[model samples]
Target: MTNRYRSVFDIIGPIMIGPSSSHTAGAVAIGHVANRLFHAPIKEVVVRYFESFAQTHRGHGTDYAIISGVLGFDPADRRVPLAVDLARRQGLKITFIEDQGLSPIGHPNTAAVTLINAEKEITVWGCSVGGGTIEIRKVDLNGLIFTPQGPLPILFVEANQPIGAALDQLFGENYRRPRVTHQLADHYIYQLDLLDRPFPEQIDQARGMSQDLTLL
Candidate 1:
């Protein structure tokens, strides 16, 4: 794993409701980030747990925590305990699968969540690396890897055409250079870790650059 911890808070953990930070809070963080990356109203969700997460999810509230995060709830949200009921009431279908046979090369607290809607589907693979921290390893069938660090805003842009130059010009000098992943010959995903919250106009500019852009 890359050295993702940047501050004392990363070591100390986040302010969240938890029985175990790794299983509960970290799970929520992963789900929340996945939801953000999906950037669409989810109609269905399928979560596959691996190894440790597969064995201890129910007991550790990992299931509920993940559901809560998928519903766009933060770790400290009061509705976490009732995430299942809430999801049902909101017409969201959810399923859980325990795949203990998966390869154990990565973190033990790992899960792959698939979010589905009418137009598109997105799969996010993430791991809770303790202390309420998480690392998103993959998105869809591509190697889109990243870790959300503090207030740094992450913008995901997916497009069929080449928009890197436009993005470079739009964020020129003001933001950190983006990490780009080529998922297909003509399709790309740009992950930009911004120094500050982008202005509404800037976001609109990005959206205009590519109809597929989704700002987090």
Candidate 2:
């Protein structure tokens, strides 16, 4: 799935430092999401490229695009080109592999990434759909389809209790209610897009839901 472009901002392509949208901007978005999922300093990572990505990644700035994004640098950041050095200075280890787009990926411009932090490993798969748009196909092996777009805050909650009720209790019913969906059995996914609103630091009272929750 691609991000909905409601304005002409996307029509002219994003304002970023990149040579190609599919290879650079999209790749940066993919890595940005992966970093959020990882949720900690990335100690090590394995990035496998496929099809067009494998063939032309180095030539099109895909390598730096991803590295800079994970390091929390925006695409327009002038420091994007120095991402690899920055990661190395932070003791991050990265390995790039060329593959035939394995895993459950259906998109051609794909990169299956395994991001390792001190506590856990996050597996994320992303695909570039061209024109600076990309799709986050899956995370942690559970099939998901969403795009991280807009300035609004987005949160994904995986919980054992009724998160809808928790959200209502936390933010109030009159507030922008979260959209709920089912992930694995005994688990629920909550997506809240409150324009410019900030979430609290704690959301307890639901079994480890806040622990696995992701804020993007």
Candidate 3:
């Protein structure tokens, strides 16, 4: 799979984290990207885990990793403990879904984050590629934009529902469902390729994290 998409290296460069870098730090990175995609100040986040993330997330601190990421913290930061409690205080609702069937096309370590601010709802799907890199697949906030369909670091215009609806109309059914795999390469690179790279910047800061956690 790696052979097929040699471009992945150009995507997510490096990262550092715990034993299961892909499942832990990488997953955390995915959550972090989702956090950014929400754009709005998140009042709540319902996190759904798939495959190994659901089964052993607790032991692996996958939940903590995700919550920290959603709170906009780095995966390698030791403040994750405090971040979890802080997120709760900030009114974030986190959940875990162990649905193997629902996660059809994603890396083994995948998650669906439903973010809400007031009555507006945003759903984001992401995958944690190894080494603390992420790929954001979907983002829909009550029809609001900021989707990967555009370009990475895609300009956040603070659009309204009506504009989002118009964008939706323009997309016309193509904006549904999140896909993160290259048929030839069978691997996910978080939001690297998913997000449009209008000004491609590859900063792999997660390099040493995986080694520290012995996730080699």
lDDT: which candidate is best?
1
Model 1 lDDT per residue over 1-216, tens place? 545565688787588887889899988877887787777788998999999999999999998899888888988888888998899899999999999686233778888888888877877777887788776666663334544342335677777777888888888775565455566666776777666557889888888777576654
Clashing pairs in 2: none
Candidate 2 lDDT over 100-142, as tens digits, reads 6453567778887778865777766788777776666566623
Candidate whose TM-score is highest:
1
Model 2: per-residue Cα lDDT at residue 115:
85
Q: What's the distance in Å from true for residue 58, model 3?
A: 1.2
Listed per model in order, the count of residue pairs whose N, CA or C atoms clash below 3 Å is 0, 0, 16
lDDT of 3 by residue, 119-150 (tens): 67777677665455555556654654333542
Worst-scoring 10-residue span by lDDT in model 2: 144-153
Candidate 1: stretches off by over 4 Å: 103-105, 141-154, 159-161, 166-188, 191-208, 212-216
**CA lDDT of every candidate:** 0.76, 0.70, 0.54
TM-score per model over all chains? 0.76, 0.71, 0.61
Considering TM-score, where higher is better, how would the candidates rank from best to worst? Answer: 1, 2, 3
lDDT of 3 at 176: 33
- The Cα RMSD in angstroms, rounded to one decimal, for candidate 3 relative to the true structure is 11.8
- lDDT score, candidate 3, position 147: 35
Question: Per the 3 Å backbone cut-off, how many clashing residue pairs does candidate 2 have?
Answer: 0
